[model samples]
Target: MAALYTTRSLSAYADLLDHAGILAARPEAAAEATTTISFATDDSREVQPGTLFVCKGAAFKREYLVNALAAGAVAYVSEVDYEIDEELGRHVPCLIVSDIRATLALIADALYDHPSGRVSVCAFTGTKGKTTSVYYLRSMLAEHAKEHGLPAPAFLTGVEYDDGVEQGESLLTTPESFVLERRIAHAAEAGCAHLVMEASSQAMKFKRTLGVEFAVGAFTNFGEDHISPIEHPTLEDYFESKLLLFENCHTAVVNLDTDVAERVLAVAQRAPLVERVLTYSLEREDADVTVQEFERTDGGIRALVRTPRFTRWLLVPSPAAFNLSNALGAITCAEALGMSANAIEFGLASARVPGRMELYPTESGRVLGVVDYAHNGMSLEALLNDLRAAYPDRELAVVFGATGGKGVDRRETMGEAAGKLADRIVITEDDPGPEDPAVICDAIAAAVSAQGHQAWQIVLDRSEAIETAVRETAGQAVIVVTGKGNDPFMLRHGVREPYEPDGDQLKRALAEWDAAN
Candidate 1:
């Protein structure tokens, strides 16, 4: 007898559905005929022959179906039936379901051979530390695997995606279910033991992470973010969406350091699928993972981790206390993953996240330039506080700008924080999309002046503002530039205009400041 193999056919896909309407030119195509789909995609251009194209999203149009069919899509999965032109009606087929988002996830899982079950999926979700915690887990897990002669862990984060073999730009925090499952399948085929990812609130709210089970789900602090007409309409919705990740994970590693910790834990405990909830804290003593002692060093911040199992020292190369909490969350997740303490300690010592608190020192040692991704009010306040704590003797000079068309209240909050905390302020452009940069700066400056800030400048050009901040601030001053972290361009009038990075501009500004002095 020949070897038997299992493959999902059109009939099997129909079996997974409780109710659906099938529209096809050929009735047999919609019936159980044993035809296997080779690929699936939501993008019309990505469709190929024998593809199951998913027509989704509230903004979807009929043109997408025509394009998908033109690109050789054999079938479509959508919430509603798409009308076809009389000439092409006979050749196109669509499977209409009530819930396209959930249907897409279930179908993608079946198509990808259920890869999430093959690897340890560890996810991090929160308002602030999701990106940083994702990076931390990848570094720690990779080091642990390398030391033990195992394959590196894979990650899908806001900054980038590491497939355990190579890194690539990440277009979204969490990709669509089809793309995400396919990437996980790639990792499983590459012999990866773990897949670490950031579960964005938007992804959770929209069911983009549906059908994927996580072994470990970590929460690293939460705040009010992504709240707008196009994003989450309110804070409660945002928080509830983040809690969705716990429902798909076996273990929950939560940070007990942020606001509303009790409420967050209460919600996570209600997740039916979560078996264990582990807590980590930088200040609270009762957490499962707690920091016993810490101090700022020339290289970074050194700390001691105390847990029920062991006490280990961690030398995290970032001075922010919030990042320490992020590291602790990663460490707790690593412990859940059975990584050794040595590997965790070593990884934390060497890991560095680009654009997150990137620091540059001047030759005179009196002026320090810092580039960070502190866009919102809460993050900005935390960053400025950390900088103030780090350099008690140095005056704090800040350059920042609010994003346009969204986060409308951030300008006032950020300006208030800077006015109270900063000695000198420079308001500049940060992705002022479709809004005048000077107008945004004026809002921030008005708030600063209201708070009695004496010295301020509004420079529309980001580079010029940075140079002015660097040149005007003299000895023992910390010149901090917030927002625009690692972004290659600025958004204006719905277009991404090419611009130099904050680090490059800072280097040039510092060089000029040096040359003039």
Candidate 2:
């Protein structure tokens, strides 16, 4: 069946669909006679049959029309006031909408059976930890409440999956808006009590997160990166764009650790619907929920969680104090939803976000290794500090650098961080998307040199960098691998290919080293 939209219903938003224009047909007949009472879309894959197909914008590819039509699209919506070729539209019906993108939204709103009113949704935005914090929130909610014994952690993510489950490879940080809502509706049908999602800076800036209200919103943290002509042009605009999430939500969950947290909180205050403000932090004593006693461990930090109702030792899995902030954000969210101490402890123990602060053990005496997604300076410094505290007497070997095609600002930032934090910094290629690996390492070296670091080397081969870092340390050392946590591919020239830079590979290498002993 085609995606259905009644002419009577669409007539109400005719001007909305066409950017101040009304729907019209070729015959110039009465709106009733010419208007598509209903037709299936042929060009857009997102548009179902009997739904309106947008035929505006020259950049619109022919493949979109062909695939959508083949899938049983029937009606067409266009701004060109022209017809698709006969082969493309022999059976497809057509009409003219004033604007194509707006029409797409209008039609999609009707097709999901109008699901917005039925769900309790939320959106999370930041440069890092969006996915991890969201997964933690969803999993916590799923375990606490048994709403009909069917309320499970349900939602879409920016990751890839092998079992069609939530945990898998991440192809994108945020998908298209059309697909995002559809996936949320599925979770709603599954009786999800909450929709926790990572709202990227790009998503909000492009208006991709519009047409929804987040019951809860958040800002994780920020740094000087993602500033580009294609991305955010400046740090202020980048921060301001992400601040929109706080406004769109009813209750805001904030991280006082964020440098821009105060400004973000101001945005939340402006929302007429915002009812409450919840906060979390590792350093701030005044936070609603805070870590009273923070102690670093071989794997991660063990923070004594303190809220008005409960105080318990919370153990984080990943080995970074940056994770301290991430875990604090999640705990604040869990508590605002009225989660118990038992539930909070349980969820914290069960919480394991892919590639955030993942750690693995090795056979060598005093050998600890961590793999993390800390591709920037703020995060790298935090992880290094935690490692230094955990093994104050030991050396810290660092491996990390910039991703290809990403801003070089991250390159300089990470370099500065490692120079200040690590005893031995071996700069390695991280994804190098389309840019040369040597180029990224040079940027890192320049930054490290400016800091007057003594022991820093540039290794374009990522695996070699990890291996060399591992080999350089003898008695006791912590090796930290930044920029690709649990990532299976190395993106070169915009295409992701198979590459594994595993910190746990040290486990096998350690065995070989121990054999010689």
Candidate 3:
């Protein structure tokens, strides 16, 4: 039997409704006459004369249907019920379901031959640490498989890896169901024994992970995030969406340090299907995975991380407690996957996430600088808190912004945190797509001002802002540039322009500052 659906393939979409517990009857036509269909997404644009063309959220548009039909799409899976009418799609064949999100999930399972059922998978979710945690688990599992001489473990992450198993760069935290299932199928075919992924709350809110199985899941932490028309409506919604991961996973590794950790843990355990649970924490001493001791050196922080199963001191250059929690979460999940101590240590020592709390030295001053992808309030607060604790006596300057369309909730919260915690604030542009830059800065400024923050400035040109923030920092002060960690592009007015002078730029500017002095 062929693995993928062909033009003559049929639908299990009605069966999906019943599974979701909707009060809809199965369409009799779906079970009997097999509708030979061609469903084309970006993965395979080439199709036979009769293919179902699907245009999905965030990346999808009507133009895709036009192009796909030109390439021979006889059907369409669209969000809108109205017709895009042409001889090809007008009356040819299209399945217009009430919810395209739900339908896409059902089709994804069918297309991938339901790979989730055959594989044990773990999903890590949160405002921070999802990417790092996924990598940590993947590395440990891969190393374990290597030492045992077993089939290599495979993974899907923000940064991808494949030993000819065809791992690709994942643009989204969680991809669309169609692409995601296809990728998982690729892993299974390549002899993957296990899978780990970074599951985003966006995946749940948008129904991206619908019908996906989760053998293990973790919640790193949560705070104000993704509050836009295209994202979640409020903090309540954000929490609700993140709650989905624990609900879906059979076993959960939760962060005991999170403000709502206890409530989330209770909810997950209360779920009828959840069988096992674990907790990692920096605060709560009773956590299954806890940081027994945290020590900072001239190099970086080193500490003994412990669990009931084992204990070891991990030395790393990553600069935040947030990163520590991320490492703990990954280690906890990896240990659960039956990895050995050696494998866990190797993965922890080697793991590095590009945009999360990456630090460097400056030539001009005795001060250290940091660049982080701390876009939301939860992440920003953690980063700021860590910075303060790391250099208690040194003054702190923050150069950051809230991305456009995420609204003032995160910006306001972040600003409030900065005013309370930071000595200097430089509000700058961060992917202000389709929204005025100054307008976004104003919201952040309002939050800071409401709390009576001092010595704050606005420089919209990002490089100029970083330079200004760096230059203004006197002796023994830290310059922290954040918001767009390792992202290559700066979005503005719906166009992705180049932004090369990021973290490196801060270092180079610091060099110039020293040169001038």
TM-score (all chains, Cα) for each model: 0.93, 0.85, 0.87
User: Where does candidate 1 stray beyond 4 Å?
Assistant: 1-7, 19-30, 83-86, 89-91
Off by over 4 Å in 2: 1-48, 54-59, 66-71, 76-109, 114-116, 145-148, 160-168, 297-300
Candidate 3: what lDDT? Answer: 0.74
* Better-scoring candidate (TM-score), 1 or 2: 1
Candidate 1 per-residue lDDT over residues 1-517, each given as its tens digit: 0011125566667666543333222225545464666777788988877777888889999898888888887777777766564758564555667777887777777777788898899999987777788888888988988997888889898778876555787878899888888778878877899999999998888888877999999888787777889789999998889988888889988888878788878877888888888999987999999999998898888888987678977898887876888888999999898888888888878887888889888786777889888888788888899899888899899999999998877898889889989989999999999899889999999999999998998988998899889988766788888888877888899898898889888877876776677
Highest lDDT among the candidates is held by which one? Answer: 1
Superior candidate under TM-score, 1 versus 3: 1
- Superposition error at 170 for model 3 (Å): 4.3
- Quick one: ranking by lDDT, best first? 1, 3, 2
Candidate number that wins on TM-score, 2 or 3: 3
Which is the leading candidate under TM-score?
1
Give per-residue CA lDDT, model 2, range 1-517, as digits (tens): 2222234433434544444344554322344243443543323645544455566455877667666666655445666544555776364445565545545544545445444445666667777777778767766666675433646655545654221123445566655545555555565565666666778877776655655567777778877778877688899988888887765577788888867878777877887778998888877889898988877665456889898788889887665666677777878877776777777776676776777666665654666777777777766777788778767988888888888776668878888888888889898788887788898899889999888898999888877787787777776777778788777788888788887646556555555555554
Q: How close is candidate 3 to the true structure, as a TM-score?
A: 0.87
Worst 10 residues of 3 by lDDT: 23-32
**Model 2 shows how many backbone clashes?**
26
As a TM-score, model 1 comes out at: 0.93
Candidate 1 worst ten-residue window by lDDT: 18-27
RMSD of 2: 4.0
